[model samples]
Target: MPGHLIRKPDPCIYSQFLLMQLNQPVTWDNPDVRILSGGVEQYTYDLTADTEYTVEITVHNSSRDKPADGTAVSIRWIEFGAGSQTRHAIADRVANVPIWPGTAIVTVPWRTPATPGHYCIEVELAHPNDGNPTNNLGWNNTQVHAAQSPVDRSIRIFNRYPRDCPPVDEGGGPYLDYRRAIYGWGALGAIGALLYAHVGHEGGMGHSYAVSVLAFYAIAAAAGLVFYRLHNERLRPRAAVARAATGGHADCHRVEVTVDSYEFDDATGKDFHPDTVFAGRTVVWPAHVDPPSFIFQPGEAFRDVTFHTDAPDDPGPPGHFNINVRQGGEPSGGVTLTITRGG
Candidate 1:
């Protein structure tokens, strides 16, 4: 011990922020918030780029120690730039807490970096005496594409019934009613005709019966065709089936997914980051969506552009459905969306 260096006491103050836990699934502040038609929210929504989407995250306090009311929750928004280049926080938000395990929601107002690329939203709790400081911080990654004409062209699949329906007899309802009616008409027509042929009456009585049978058969055929057209080969009545089993309408949980930007040409005027080039730029998706329990993993060669749950039926014409976007290993943040009858 040459010269016995005097060590100075640590001067940095530290407090354990709220610990992130799963009291309930963390999702966007408002995932399905609809911007009204021609309203201010809609106007602002339309004017801003995709990066302008404010990410609101909800965190939970698992620790027994209650976080003081008005404690600050720090949120850091960062962009992962091209190859080893230094990057700094694009924005920061400090959300005040009402109590631990309560008021855990934080809103990062700044638009995602103007640069279209992979971005991360990191949330941390600022509190002292936190037994585990390491757990105070967590992050989630998402890709920001050049804004398109239809800002959010996400595909929605409605299919929560299959998961919620009871195991037994999940089929029967308006769908079944139509199917039964079709079968009844066809069967009655055939039986009536066969009986008339076997036991004929005099003077057109048999013809009259045969004519009635033909009418029934024609109606049945028409009904069948209508059903086929409405419910195409790939479409399944999963929601109806669940409703029948549960004696209530199946929840229409819309799974909204992010649509990818395919190109960065002159047509894409928003693509104006001089430091970065869009050509050959790869997007990094969450390794898993709603992970640990439900995971969607696109292989190494393929970059996952969208995350969605299994749809009950084939992709139908664009329509509104309840949407939930859970980035794997990260809290779900709501994306500003403008819904229309058709997109």
Candidate 2:
């Protein structure tokens, strides 16, 4: 211990620096989509964010309606922002219908945003589907969410992952945690052995218990490595998990849902606004399909439509209400409802 001042730096230090940079996760998109009118055509995808991706859209006509041999069609792109401002849309393509039940794709280039976050890609059809080629076409939007990279927090040797999306099996039981720590200590233990060897050579104690010091260092080094890896690995899922859970996390709040039209009987229904997200900040429509069937109370928390299914049934059908949550220009988290019966 007295002559330790002349020791050299640990060779594993470089590993430590590399491990830090490898663990943060990049972003991804969800790509949820919808098309206008009733038809068999739909978009299918197994998506990823860190890779170059492509999208395909096919419009199939209702068996009942068929276009004369050929028709015209187009696809458009709209970017939906988090807060309650009008989403920006960029027209992408328009082409002649090649098949009766046709399929096409507008390649969404892999261009990362300047700011890091999730973004929804909305595609609207400007031309009609094959079934009703004469009918005007419309636009719809979908989300493309990102995934996070993994981290290396081992004490001795660092584990570096670029994105936050930790591998599903990253979690290990107690035995595994200890195994990693011991592994790291193994690295440091090497240095300890070198010191012990130097000291033993000068003292000529090669045949004594002084050599056991090497064993002690081995165990200590491993425990540190294992402990470090386990700690950082637990936190990588937070970013993407939050990204997938809720919507409109922007500063103001945004709720916008595209729709065909609203149906009402002439009472409280007359004032129903399909484009206006209830208090005006959430996107809650697009004529949301299979909107949860449920009842509502007058004073319950009104942000999530999913919560409506839990609401106490009202006195009558006239009072039924439903709509998407609005975030841009009105009440921050509350949602608008389309009342079906009890009013």
Best by lDDT: 1
lDDT of 1 by residue, 91-148 (tens): 4444444333343445455554454544434555554433344445544432222322
Q: What's model 1's lDDT at 155?
A: 23
TM-score to native of every candidate shown: 0.29, 0.25
lDDT of 2 by residue, 1-343 (tens): 5434432211100111121123211111111233212332222212333433343444333232332233233333323221122344433554333332343333333332344433334333333222222223222222211211111110110111112323343446455656656655665675666676777553444544445555656667666765667665665466446645754132222333221222222112346553432222222222241322222222222222222222224444222122222223222111112223223
Superposed Cα deviation of residue 285, candidate 1 (Å): 17
Backbone clashes for every candidate come to: 10, 84
**Candidate 1 all-Cα RMSD:** 25.7
TM-score of candidate 1 to 2 decimals: 0.29
